[model samples]
Target: MDPYRRLVRPALFRLDPERTHEAAIALAERVGRRLPRAQIDPALEVTAMGLRFPSPIGLAAGFDKGARAVDAWAAVGFGFAEVGTVTPEPQAGNPRPRMFRLGSDHALINRLGFNNPGSVVVASRLAAARARGRVAIPIGVNVGKSRDTLAERAVHDYAAAVERLWPYADYVVVNVSSPNTPGLRDLQARSALGEILTAVLDVDVRSAEWSGEPRRPVLVKLAPDLSDEQVDAVTELALELELAGVVVSNTTLSRAGLRSPAAMTSEEGGLSGAPLRLRSTELVGRVARRAEGALAVVGVGGVSSARDAWDKLAAGASLVQLYTALVYEGPSLVRRINRELARMMRERGIERVADIRSAG
Candidate 1:
């Protein structure tokens, strides 16, 4: 008898998917202060990237692309929220009908192409939110190359975003793995990624010196489609660059074993949700194995329940995030997952989330 599943979802699902999402964001913006906050078990608190998260579960990037719902996300019980796949300049993004729902499989396909209100506007919104003291949790900004930027100039594009948005960002994620933007994933090449990250680090150093605040930790969001060697290389590069962590994966291009209609599945976009769970978890474990305690791993992709979150934690993810599942399971899913994670921890006599992989 979950209210969202039986009542809210049916009505929301009737609209086109993107429209439904727009409506959701609009509602969150309006009712954020009035919405009841979800409580987390004290035992679930996590320490990663030198910040304390009230819970280990976070809302992944792409949902709140413009930092519009920063307060709302914390009110809804997320330990932290990562906003944006924001670009240096604004663009309308790919044409309409870009997002599709796969109800049968509890998944989605989208080619939204990082449609956002650019860095300047988004930075303004974040500044406003912070000025009001409405921010309740750490907010990470995820930056992507502008669609019009040439591949050779990608480093400057990402560095510009980090430089512009760093003041408000508790952490930053260099997004080179989203498949929706052309030539985006190609930047994941070791040499190319190294250059981009190095430039971003340089920005971080300057920002810290200028503001007199601690340097914001930086992470890289990678794709789930990389080969084992590619994954290891990126993991090594993260350690070499002294990155705070890696977000182990954006959505995938793979469409294997789907129950959705052929027409829906045939749409050109990255796939997310249940179909991505196993592979994402596997990649997280791979990165963790390679990092060997040197880097934090933020696990994402297809987590719908507490068990799924636990699987990622046990696989070596220090923190976990969700997006597609929220589409299917609704907001209360966050509280339910955290509560269940606490119960599971109690049953196993574990104290903190970061110790999961080691305890296993």
Candidate 2:
């Protein structure tokens, strides 16, 4: 009965991964227009970062970098959508052929850079979506430095994005974690991250004043390749900065257990999907244990099913994200997970998804 796996996926998988991704987004935008809003169970609701998401599952940022598919996420059943790893201006990103599929491993390695059409364009698109009454749920805007921006100047670059998209966003994410951009990961260090956070927090205050609105939440996303010491350091910094929360992980640089051919495995980019599930879940547990209720955690990287989502929540993730799974499992994955997750939650006598966070 699954048409995506039976027909759509077979055809999409036949093309190169990046182009297929583009086609998927275009298809989503078109399909989203005709689809009815996704139904949800109130028990699946999660309130975090000062907003209430109808479900704990969200679509990660890379899937809609330019905010071109705001309505598509809601139409497809995501409780929320985090869009853009957007920068100040448009860039071609790395050269083409940058995304590779590892069907044997159910994973993807992508070095797409932050190839968004820039913050202005993304903000405009989001604005239009809002005008049309399309944003049915919270939209988190993930902002990062431009590829050409130096480490020293990165703070201003991030500040610029938060300023540009501030009004429309339900929350903002500071992405110093993606490996595709040169020197981007270096910003995760204490001093560098402190500077960026300070500037971004200032920008939030400015946006609040400018719009006469409440200050929006700003959280940090970290690359999974960080050492324990580094992870602890970043965690401490997040707590110190009093951030809205932390997204426990971004794509990883590790290629430890991939079954894909060496050529595909050797590709330079962050690896996401099943291979990342365990490590990211552990990190979620670690960070959750470390934060000890001082901060919120959004678990991402490798969730695909109800059990996977359960693992993340039990490990202390208040919410979770899906990206690569959508590539392999199709759109129904979110709703299916929500349905099964609700069943699991009910068995435990819990009414809200938030109750299971760190339950184990």
Candidate 3:
């Protein structure tokens, strides 16, 4: 039996979702050295954004918002791990009770409001992790604007994050889709998104030059709630920006077809997990059709099973990530997904995630 679901999850679930997460992070830090290794499959190897990942299954951002326990992800057997949704300045984030669990739905609702210790502190932690040689896999930083930052000034916050965090980031994820932040989604529009990407890309260039490092890969995270036309617009924008990839979604506010209680389901936050799978995969297909394979797509949302992960790949995602699934399935979820994915590919005389998409 999966120890997490059999034992750990029950105990953790007893507390609120956020508390369980915090407790786990603390435990990971103290016992990470003893954590069992995740089984790695050769077929799971993938190259995206000019970077190689040991596997395509990665831990999505929002779990390690402060960049702490970054090194623990590798020990837990993730192909990669992304940290932060950090802003330029620290903010308490919406009020208490901002995070909730919908166990019946295998989903989560969070209005964390880009909560973190701010970019500077998070950057320092990441730098420290890199210097200490703590991480076993590639690490990306997810950057966003602060709550108090006006919509027009969002670019400055993004640029600042890229400038300070790219030195330690394998890539930088520009998050403009979180429903928790007011007017943040407005940045997803063509004109606004273009300006933000332009400023960040410019800073990315200068940061590379100043740090004497190679140009860092930049990606934008989109929302699952966008209209089909909006998805197409963002795809075109990403293509024009020549971005490394697009993280197919951040979260959604839609509670359609959810089985959670009305109160929990009605909470104001982005929804993630099983409820989001079909829509997210559908969005991946739309974006991929629009991309024509020019840029990469990292799939997130509702990937609780290998088939779900495979579905995303077949639809056009070169990589996949999950946060809520881990909460419900356990850390072994990574190894299980990779093993099943590799087996599924081998059975079809296929190899690599991209081939899965190409075959379709």
**Highest-scoring model, lDDT:** 1
Tens digits of per-residue lDDT, candidate 3, 101-121, equal: 999999999988877998889
Name the candidate that leads on TM-score.
1
Off by over 4 Å in 1: none
> Candidate 1 at residue 126, lDDT?
95
How far is 216's C-alpha from truth in model 2 (Å)?
0.6
Q: Is candidate 2 or candidate 3 better by TM-score?
A: 2
User: How many residue pairs clash in all the candidates, one count each?
Assistant: 0, 0, 1
What are the models' TM-scores?
0.98, 0.98, 0.97
Q: Give the TM-score of candidate 3.
A: 0.97
Clash pairs (backbone) in predicted model 3: 273-302
lDDT of 2 by residue, 77-125 (tens): 8899999998988888999889999998889999999888999999899
For residues 1-360, could you state the per-residue lDDT of candidate 1 as single tens digits? 899999999999999999999988988988885665667899999888899999989999999998887879877889999999889887789999999999998999999999999999999999998997878788999999988899999999999999999999999999999999999999999999999999999999999999999999899999999999999999999999999999998999999999988989999999999999999999999999889878889999999999999999999999999999999889889999999999988898898887777777
Q: Give the lDDT ranking, best first.
A: 1, 2, 3
Which residue runs does candidate 3 get wrong by more than 4 Å? Answer: 33-37
What range of 10 consecutive residues in model 1 has the weakest lDDT sum? 31-40
In model 2, how large is the Cα lDDT of residue 19? 88
Deviation of model 3 at 357, angstroms = 1.1
